[model samples]
Target: MLSHHIQINDHPFHYLGWGDRNDPVILMLHGFPEYSGAWAEVAEDLSRDHHCVAPDQRGYGQSWAPEDVNAYRTGKLVGDMVALIEHLGSRPVMVFGHDWGAAVAYALAISRPDLVSHLIIANGVHPAPFQRALAAGGAQTAASQYIHWLRREGSEEQLAEDDFAKLSSLFGASMDMGWMTPERRAAYLEEWRRPGRMRGMVNWYRASPLRLGQPGEVITDLPEMPTHTLRVRMPHLLIWGERDTALLPEATEGLEDYCDNLTRVTIPNADHWILHQESHRVAAEVRTWLKRL
Candidate 1:
């Protein structure tokens, strides 16, 4: 495996890579509060057959973290992935994303399907389904209260205070932390402490127009999303951790409505951090699923 930095859209982007460059590419995208290293275990398992590349998307880790919230908007976020794929000299590479990264992957697949061969997402929501659940205002709404909290002014300061005590708590929230040992925790902290990185990560939430609605209230003011431009035609796979409290299974409820070739798998034992908590299972599922492609 190798770690390298490249310029994408005039911004420095850092990524971790594995496997021979000549092999088919499998690009991995990490979620919030985590960097490219989040896919270490899965990348190691898949590198034998496929080249795996996981980037610290624009505003995370050692990548360029723009101070403006507008810089983290969906179009800009998807553009970063598009530029990186072009930079890698590959067309329509297999793409995988988790959490916030998954949202970017979805956007990329929708907006620029020519750049994605297959879309694989774990524990991430399709915007439409997520919006429905977020607007419905029940379990998902309560679980997503953190989104509102993160959007507050000075929330980044709180996350960074007390040596990132509040941020550290996010790892073990309603889930097991056995995978996050002292060393792993230290590494995550190192990434989070990068200058301006924490704030940049929070900007993703701030830039999003999705908001948590009151119980029994549905959002009707969502911006128009033209159907022709917002659907996924490439084969798509969704690996879900059934126990993810933050994003319930309901988030995947209507995913197929937007995907032409869709497959969904639920890992009963896993939670939000399934990539780390159940790397073997996740890797095996990915391998088996990709074989059909």
Candidate 2:
């Protein structure tokens, strides 16, 4: 893999690139507390036919981490992606996002449709459903209690004091055992040990109150761009792990309301960390979709 840093405004974002530069681009965004390396297996496959770029989105790995909470907001995160794409010569790129990265991908497709050609969302739902669930005050709220804890003052300090053992353990516990293998777990631990990385990862939750609370006017309406409209209009694919604890099946209850061209798949006995647990299957599915696209 080829690695480099691209300056997005004031912050320098670290990214890993694979495949030929002349090939069509696919930008992969990883989730919170995880670095760009999470896309290792997937990118290796996709890079054969596409220029795959996986970035340590803002707060993880070698990416720039701004101390201000607002810097981690969804809007700003999406903006950083738009800037990165522009920096890469302003071509329309397909987007693949997992977990929090999926959320950012959704926002990017909606907010800047011209920049994204297609979207592949994994293990996460649209923000509207997430906000409603959080506000409804039941299992959804209970499932998301960790976000509340992360947003609390000094929460980062506490996690830091333990040398991020708790954070690593949390990832291991939340994911399927098969997914968090010794090698995968070690990779995550190595990234977490980087200076100020934990705080930056936690900041994603801290800065997303607007979407996490309620759908504001900005996102309430369908995106004006052709790619941002309802499900039937955009070319899309959704891969879900049925055993996901944080995002229950109910969270996807009304997803069809937005997607135009959509295909949904459920992996049996898998959890939130589907990319790791079923990396080959995920890569095959993505490869098939790209061929169709």
Candidate 3:
């Protein structure tokens, strides 16, 4: 494995890498409250056949984190990745994103299809459908109430209080966290301890364009997103952890309509942290799916 620190879009960026230059590259994007090391296990396995690069995106880990919520906007977040991929030979590579990472991945694929040959998402939702689900005020709306609280002012302070008791609970909420061992938790603590990191992390939620309503409050006025901007034109893979409570399956109910070539898989007994809980199965699924290409 290798550690990288370079200037991307005028800010210092950090990423972890596995395998050598000769291997095909698989760019990994991790979600909220997690860092590039979140891909350590799966990347280690995939390194046997591919070079895996997982970056500590804009606000997390050692990456440049602007406290400005605008920095977390979809275009800025996607632009940061565009710069990274350009730095990595400017070739279309397999892009895998989880949770918040999926937001950027989807935007990259949509705005610059030439940069992504394949799109993979684990326990994440597309903005259009996710917005619709939230507007409907259904199960997903109820499941996503945390977003509202996260968008509130000083929520980061609350998360940082009591030794991050609130943030820790958020991590373990409605999900199985047994996969989080002591060392792993300690690493998370260390990263979260970084100055302004917590605020930057929650900025992702605050900067979100998707609107939410109180439980059962149907919102019909959320503006529609341009269809051309949300379509996934490349071969796509959708992996779901069936037990994920934060994003119910209904959130992705119509994902097929947005992709021409799509494949889906579900890992039982796994939750939002599927990457950690079922890294083996996720890697195997990725390997088997790629074989079909």
- Candidate closest to the true structure, highest TM-score: 3
Better of 2 and 3 by lDDT: 3
Two-way lDDT contest, 1 vs 3, winner: 3
Ranking by TM-score: 3, 1, 2
lDDT of candidate model 3 versus the reference: 0.92
Cα lDDT for residue 283, candidate 3: 95
Q: What stretches of model 3 exceed 4 Å from their correct place? A: none
Instruction: Write down the TM-score of every candidate.
Output: 0.97, 0.88, 0.98
lDDT for each candidate structure: 0.89, 0.78, 0.92
Kindly list the per-residue Cα lDDT of model 1 for residues 1-293, writing each as its tens digit. Answer: 79999999887999999999888899999998899999999999989888999999888999999989999999999888889899899887999999999999999998898899999999998898888788877788878888878998899999999999998887579987789989998899899999999889999999997768755666777766555667999999999998888899777777777889999888999999999999989999998998887
- Please name the candidate that would achieve the greatest lDDT relative to the true structure: 3
- Candidate order (lDDT): 3, 1, 2
RMSD after CA superposition, every candidate: 1.2, 4.3, 1.0
| Tens-digit lDDT string for candidate 3 (141-168) | 9999999899999999999998899999
- lDDT of candidate 2 over 62-154, digit per residue (tens): 889777788888878998899999988847888999989998998898777788888888798777666656665566666766776778777
